[model samples]
Target: MSEEEHQHPTSHYVKIWAILLVLLAVSVTGPMLEIQWVTLLTAFGIAGVKAYMVAVKFMHIDQTPRFVTYLVTTTLVFMLLFFAGTAPDVMKDHGTNWEKPAWIAAEAAYAAGEVSHEPEHH
Candidate 1:
C-alpha cells in the first residue's frame, strides 16, 4: 500500500482538536450551574455529544458496514432508553408511605407481636 492509502491529513487532527475544545468547555461549565434539573440535563447532553464525536470521528465508525453500525447504534439507543426511563423513578421521593412513624408504628408492631424488639448481636 502507498503512503496515500494511509494518510489522514492535518485537517483531521484540527477537527479532533476543535471537538476536544468543545468537550473541554462543556466539562468545565457543566458543574458550575446551580439549577439541578438544567444542570443534570446539560451535563448528560454534553456527554452524549462528546461520546458521539469520539465514536464517529476517532473510532472510524463510518468505515464499518451499515448493518454493523446500525446494530451497535441500536444497542446503545436501547441502553440509553433503559437508563433514562429509570432515572426519574429512581430519584423520586416515594414519600412517608414507605417510612414508619417510628414511635407509633414500632410500638404497635411490638405490642401486636408482629415484630421482635430484641437486639441482634453484630
Candidate 2:
C-alpha cells in the first residue's frame, strides 16, 4: 500500500463519534427544553450538522469530486424550495372560499336520475 492511502487520518472518525454523542444526548433529553421555537430550531440545526458530518466523514463523500457535491447540493436546495413554497397553501385561511359548488349536488342528482322538468300552462 502507498503512503498517500495510509495518510488518510483517523481524526475524522473521532470527530464523527463526538458529534454523534452530542446528537444522542440531545435526542435523549430534547423534550425537557422549554424555549419553544428556539429549541426546535437549535435541535434541527444540530441534527443537520451531525448528518452532514456523518455523510462527509463516515461515508467518505468529502473525497468525492466537485461535480457530485454540486449535484447533491442542488437537489437539496430545490427540495427545500418546493417544500417552503407549498406549505402555505396547505395551511391558509380558506373560509367561505372553501365551499363546494352547487353544480356538484346537481351532478349527483342527475346521475341518480332525479331531475325534473315541468311546464306551466296558463
Can you give the TM-score per candidate against the true fold? Answer: 0.53, 0.60
lDDT of 2 by residue, 8-109 (tens): 578857877987997868855674675767577667867887878877777767777778888878988999999999876654434346834465676677
lDDT of 1 at 118: 54
TM-score of 1: 0.53
The 10-residue segment of model 1 with minimum total lDDT is 91-100
For model 1, the stretches where C-alpha displacement exceeds 4 angstroms are: 1-7, 81-122
lDDT of 1 at 47: 76
Candidate 2, overall lDDT? 0.71
